[model samples]
Target: MNVKTEVKQIGLYINGKYVPSSSHRTFEVKNPATQGVIALVSEATEEDVNQACLAAREAFENGPWRTMSVAERCEKLRRMAEIILERKEEIAGLDAIDVGKPYHSTVQHEVPRAAHNIHFFADFVQMQGGETYPMEENFVNYTRYEPVGVAALITPWNVPFMLTTWKLGPCLAAGNTAVIKPAEMTPLSVSLLGEIAKEAGIPDGVVNVVHGLGSVVGTALTEHPAVDLVSFTGSTATGKRIMKNGADTLKKVSFELGGKAANIIFEDADLDKAIPGSIHAAFMNSGQVCLAGSRILVQRSIFAEFLERFTKAAMELKVGDPQNIDTKMGPLVSEQHYQKVTSYLEIAKEEKAKLICGGKRPELPEYLQKGYYLEPTVYVQENPKSRICQEEIFGPVVTLIPFDTEEEAIQIANDTEYGLNGVVWTENLQRAHRMSHSVRAGTIWVNCWFVRDLRAPFGGFKKSGVGREGGHHSLEFFTEAKNICIALK
Candidate 1:
């Protein structure tokens, strides 16, 4: 455990307490930023997962959380949000250590937003809707939003704390109990969330955590008969599998999965505005974000110039220790992922894409040892259909492809199977609006890139996976509808 002060060990959380998993098996969480092991986490088995699920089910069926009124529940969530705000630094520090998230960004961007998200959902739920019926039946009719009991939340390692809040907030707000299965790689920060919830007076077993591999804990949670809903964030392939297993009981399932987003930059775009935003979109979090604007679509007129600007901007990004506030980027999560990314470099080379900047691992920086690191890379390709153009590298890499017309830009943007998000960069308000409608992605960003507001619904259209997270639209993910009828005579 004697490594960087930035990496630390983590324990599992269950029934309002932190403890090791019954199954002593463990996994290492690698910091993508440093490509180093940040924490060693306990791996939960099927039995352990069942224990967590049963705890959540019991809480939902008979515990204080389920018994609480909407107003009471909202109060609890607000209290939890307050507790999070009070302990923001400690939790933010945990995120930087456990996941190698940039501390400055984690503090200013992720942590506050997470706390606000819980509060926002709490406020949103206070206005829970039930429609008054104009029924012709022998009974009066209405509909109330009811929580899907025993929610199984399987969150990814990338944005562990924030995604945990996203899954936890509306779930509790909707009166459901949750068994959260944090990815083995990034389990501790979420465990800390469990701690904060406990301190904020979440009743025992209201929220439980079992840290482990997806195949073990994740499958168990999805397949458990007692679990009523499964919310997952990961690959599209894994989301499909979760849906299949949850279908055994026909449980309600929501997925926020993979993305190969297209970021369209037109000739009319203000390159001054678009270049910086595009660089951030393509390279933020080292481009590991599911909605990272990975595919850069530029009009033929501006393609060369945009490439130059984008390449310079990407190179300008400083990748180092995420704990450093001045560091703009970091390593990929692990050597495995870094290798996967490097392989993509080979593929890009075979496809005849020009490497405008980095495509290989950087020599050891003076400040770090024992972490996987890759230099930021930019690829310029003549063919939009190149393999590098379509595949998701999920690294600090950018592909610059040229498009001839607005129609072709839309076509290229919509060409991918993954459509989580896309950006249309044009000063012309009309063109921005047009392609926003035309793109097949779940979220369409016009002019601005990666400015993800909490109110906007986020998800993908085709292969980006099913269901939406965030926005007023998120309530549907945690709720099921029921109609009550009575005669209006």
Candidate 2:
């Protein structure tokens, strides 16, 4: 818990330089692993957001970025990826301390994945080409893709580095200038992105980072008329607000929103694989992931035994300081989020749900006593229609439900308004395919979980989100298509 880390003051990256907020106000960035303030970051006001938007618009309209050849744009992104990889350790440490993510997960998965995201888009930009078709004997038709001008990328807190590049990579690869507003809760790692872009030799105003609370800066960024597109990753409720605000300009909006995925484990499943995969789906990132399979649906025959094994695994999860490489679960992102999760525990109790394991905060190491920690909570829902069964807790809490038939399992899984991610654990390949098809979700995992290919389209089906992002899907979203018709003489 006493791991040494470098601390420095943080500021907004406007145009091509790091600067203070116009209002000169700042907020503390705390280490959730120890509840210590590690740095102070400038809090952008409405004015600051406007300035960033103006800069993005200017860059898109008048700067070399938009006019740059596709190969040139891709080269810059590739260079940024190299810079990001060079600072992998530092960024991983920052993510671990900034968002209370386990050190190993950050170091092994998030940081490297972010760098790969940049490079992936770079490759996409290089490989993708325009289309040409012969319409009639005397006419020719062709289609070309162009950048969507200024794009606003509003990313969330849980996985800052990964999500930052999720939006940034495609935005840059498509030759669009951008203004990024990282969630105020976890801003350290993304605040450094501007520096990396500058080092990568990206033209000025191509990428900008503004920091502030969502209510102030987020609203301003989405509502700005000059912004041609808004790509936001956050809660469903907030995504709705962004949609409404962006309606004035009819700006193109892309959202990757909330998810309450149902992890169904059938009686025919390989318990060894199913058990750990389901538990991991629910508990990864301390259950803070939007794709966390928080709802567990078990075949009635194996309900009791599965619950017992799942409870034991949940209890054994190492809950403590994120700085400890051995820790399996770290603290929640903030005191507010901790309270929200705990409040749901009380709600489960009131609704007469069974608390099989972990309903209270774990005793932390002496140095981390003040950290916002919570035990991995498992609940058995008596009523399938209960709020605890339907709502997104966004913490290390999962609800178990028993299903008698495959039809019932599919019904329960698709009952929620969210259709983000789902899992079906079964040895029977036919059943796996059926359940995966039956469940209405964007991503389906069969006998596995969280396995991503980066090339496939990723997005939610219903209230979860709008549009897809991954590989060429992302590149397409960041760009606009124009068809040209020519007559041959």
TM-score of 2: 0.98
What TM-scores do the predictions have? 0.95, 0.98
lDDT over C-alpha atoms for residue 485 of model 2: 93
lDDT of candidate 1 at residue 372, scale 0 to 100 = 62
Worst 10-residue lDDT window, candidate 2: 1-10
How high is the lDDT of residue 358 in model 2? Answer: 89
Tens-digit lDDT string for candidate 1 (1-489): 112455465777777777777868777776555445666777787887777878777878888887688888888889999988887777777777666657788878888878988998999888767887674565677887888788888898778888889888988888888888877766777877777778878888888888777887788889999898888889888998898888879998778888888888888888888888888898788888988887888888877777777787777778778787787876676667768888988898889899999886666566556666778898888787888888778888878888898888888887778888888888888877788888888888887866666677877788777777776667888887888776656
Candidate 2 lDDT, 1-489, residue by residue in tens = 344555668999999999999989999888887777888899999989899999988988999998878888889889999999899888988888889888877878888899999999899788888889996588898988899999999999999989989889989989999999999989989999988998998988989999999889999999999899999999999999999999999999889999999999899888899888877898889999999989999999999999999999888899987877789999899999889888998899789999888888798768888988888999999577888889999999999999999999988999999999999988888888898889999999998999988889999999999999998888788999999999997
True-structure RMSD, every candidate: 2.2, 1.3
Predicted structure with the largest TM-score when compared to the true one:
2
Q: How displaced is residue 288 in candidate 1, in Å?
A: 0.5
Against the true structure, whose lDDT is highest?
A: 2
